[model samples]
Target chain A: MSTPALDATLAPAAGAADAATPGTARARTTAGLRGWAVRLGSLAVVVALWQWLTATDARVGLRFDRLPSPTEVAAEFGRQLGTGVYYLDLAQSMIRILTGFALAAVAGIALGVLVARSRWIGDLLLPPIEVVRPIPAIALVPIAILVFPTDEQGIVFITFAAAFFPIMVSTRHAVRALPTLWEDAVRTMGGGRAHVLWNVVLPGTLPGVFGGLSVGMGVAWICVISAEMISGEFGVGYRTWHAYTVVDYPAVLVGMASIGVLGWVTSASIELLGRRLTRWLPRGEGSAR
Target chain B: MSAPAAEAARVDAGLAIRLEGVSLGYGPHAVLDDLNLDIAPGEILVIVGPSGSGKSTVLRAIAGLLTPRAGRVLAEGVPVTGPSPDRAMVFQDDALLPWRTVRRNVELPLRIRGVPKRERRTAAESWIARVGLAGCEDRLPRELSGGMRQRVQLARSLAGTPRAVLMDEPFGALDAQTRGEMQRLLLDVLRDTLATVVFVTHDVDEALLLADRVVVLGRGGIGCVLSVPDPRTPDIDRAGLRARIIEEL
Candidate 1:
């Protein structure tokens, strides 16, 4: 990523020097393409090995009935895609994740800034946050169900719990990590406290807050899946649990694959948005994709 | 000597800045002690000292970034309680908002002052061209070299058109060649504007090259205030000025 940007920046100057130098640009493009091909090939090799093991007598116990072959999983996925159930589950999972993630991001950042900036608030609130952060969000499922009347609210709460701590911690750390000079610069420029917080402190904390968001999103998926397994009537997690009860190993594998793909796509989207928001940061290229 | 005498003198001369018995410290450590200085209109005073000599603290006090424990700071007969737009500061690090382009960075003070957009843009453009950043108006600070960034910072300070400018080692981070070029550029700009400037630097040659009056800060209080005889003229004997400053140091 850094190389591409550097190449782009130097390209105009390099072009002026030698218009006939096609070899250099071609070499870089080919190297990038080759890297991608290697990654794809490695993935294909893993699937082939899995298929070979499933076909052999070595596929026993957990491998025999509980786990499905790659071919079987793919066929089940294709079938589910045709029936439109896969898309529905995918959309449902996304809505839950996004709703929870957005809420966590908004609340976490605000609270994080408040705590980092104010000594009184930080002293009062930080201890509870630290204590609660260590407990797994999945463990709160039972308690959430007891408190909330509906299953959806409880599941969303679990997702929120999973994502909130990471974002808050990241935001607080980002705020703290800012150089005192940044604040001094603004203050000396005749900026008020509100102006300093809005302009300098907020922008400086964004990169770190996004880092927290990424970690929180991953955890949200884990807890969301666990929540669905316990009480959800719908979603990929629910479908996967249902498949497990019926001994439909291929469907279970399909569900797992769907979750993985959804998680990757959603996380990538968040990261992309983060890059756009922090386009001014010097180290932006690494996080752009 | 006496409070009434100092007040009467300031009223008569129209003092732009007056620091009376100012002392600054952090917890138990005293950085500056019992310092007195007066800056009149159109006066270009350069503070010279070694590292940890509290030259920066003096600038900070004037800029209202630091509050002195023992004395008062007055700007135009009014007490400087906090940072005000009347006195603009240029920091050593350039402190241009990395996200903003050169033009935007230079225009920030005017924007904060609630100047209309079209007027601010015109003002910003002129200052950008003045600082030799005419072609790089749309370029961000990160895209510019160290010297260019400092130039942008200088443009920003001048665009505000403040009553006084406080510059804290503004060219300290640049390479020797760039630093020399910047020093020359600053002198040219100041000569044209006639803006009262309080510049702080450790380099003896720099103080000699730019200042109308060089204040060598030793220990705490002002060591000496050596007036440069012929700074308004374009041609100056660089060697003679350096020798004079070296002797003072």
Candidate 2:
């Protein structure tokens, strides 16, 4: 009897209305617009500063006389965009990344789950993986060049190597870190080994696996570009290196800017995908209790 | 929002659980030794003990999650082996999977048993509503309050129509007021089924309120067993029983 009284007494105060009104909604929109303005404004300021320094050839502490101006880079960017070769390079680089990343995702997740699931497998496999993990994937360019017949394959291998360790390691940790309570709960309810794996281990590891994926994507980009620069006959990194050799300063600037955009876009996509996959996470359900 | 009146009460009289000279432990550390006990069908038996008294270990053995070092546990005259759907265990920590929505969590046991998808959904929603979570079918565990999460756990456990339910301080983590409500709600829910309950709690008051038989565990074994009178009777007094339980601790 007292239980109902306790709940009912608290219920009136607990039912806090959403409280959003016309005035607050307008305020929220204004705040959002202001936030975008600040972000875009910051980028515009940096571009304007760069343009001024290059156009005037300012040498406050370092010389900008040899660097390409914003207009020069923009014009070069437009010219490159019109050419079929530029698109080819873009496609080649993207294909290499996608192929390597896809292969790595499959293998890393499989091996990670395998090693984590069985103790003997972990003992046998983890030692060699840990040994190789610390060595930079870019540093493997020499071995890749020697072992692979084609530069394309070598670059892809490098990307795969760069991405594999992070994904594997994070997945392993995620699996091991899962709460035993879940497994026990399922088991008590007559769930078998497969059910435990499907219901608990895999879903529980998603957040950690995605965390590694985002990091692996970033690292793979780094190694792929370096591998291209070192050994590739084509691709964005190769083209950028070629521009440098030819002293096409504006083309080099265009390459650098394009790489920046590509990296940002890929990473942003990974994060968005990760967020969608783990939508059940509390997000910003604030406060500790 | 229909109450699953028929299926919810499907566990007719529950199973009789027996521990015959059972010795339970974890790898060289003995928690209970030569313990013998019998849990009556459809009875609420509460085990109260100080920390490390193996109250939970005993519950685990009956739930068939732990193997006794010596002797055996029998459920309905059959030797208990591995975990079975006939016995469901609820933990103090809300063990609802964080990734699963309320409906899916409630549907897990049914799904494991190969129950049809449509029927499982209907059963899950029925239990969800019966537990007073009518509109929270899609909410994740993390989105719910602690008390609400416990309610979901209760629904999830009972939805399976288990013969015996083992609860390990299921409301120990709640605030005082919420704990009281949960206790009330548990009694209300139990009225719908004849499942045997082995509730382990540190709170003596909780045991007195819920149990037909209160077993006090101490020194790695049963210290005493007290029978709680129906509190609804205006003339019966059990103050001495409460004091004995407190003194045994």
Q: Rate the local accuracy (lDDT) of all candidates.
A: 0.83, 0.88
Instruction: Name the runs in model 2 displaced over 4 angstroms.
Output: A1-32, A285-289, B1-13, B229-236
lDDT by residue (tens digit), candidate 2, B1-249: 365778545545688999999999999989889999999999999999988899999999998889999999999999999999999999888599988999999999999999999999999999999989999998889889999999999999998889999999999999999999999889989987889999999999888888899999998599888888784233466788889999988
| Tens-digit lDDT string for candidate 1 (A1-289) | 2345445555665554445677776775678679878978999999988887776735454465335789888888889989877778777778888888889989899889989999999999999998898999999988999999999999899999999999999999999998777677667667788878976899878889999999999999998888889998889999999999998989999999889988888787777778678777776442322
- Return the top candidate by lDDT: 2
Q: List, in the given order, the native-contact fraction of each candidate.
A: 0.49, 0.89
List, for all models, the DockQ compared with the true complex. Answer: 0.53, 0.73
Model 1 chain A: worst 10 consecutive residues (lDDT sum): A1-10
- Give every collision pair in model 1: none
Which window of ten consecutive residues has the lowest lDDT sum in model 2 chain B? B229-238
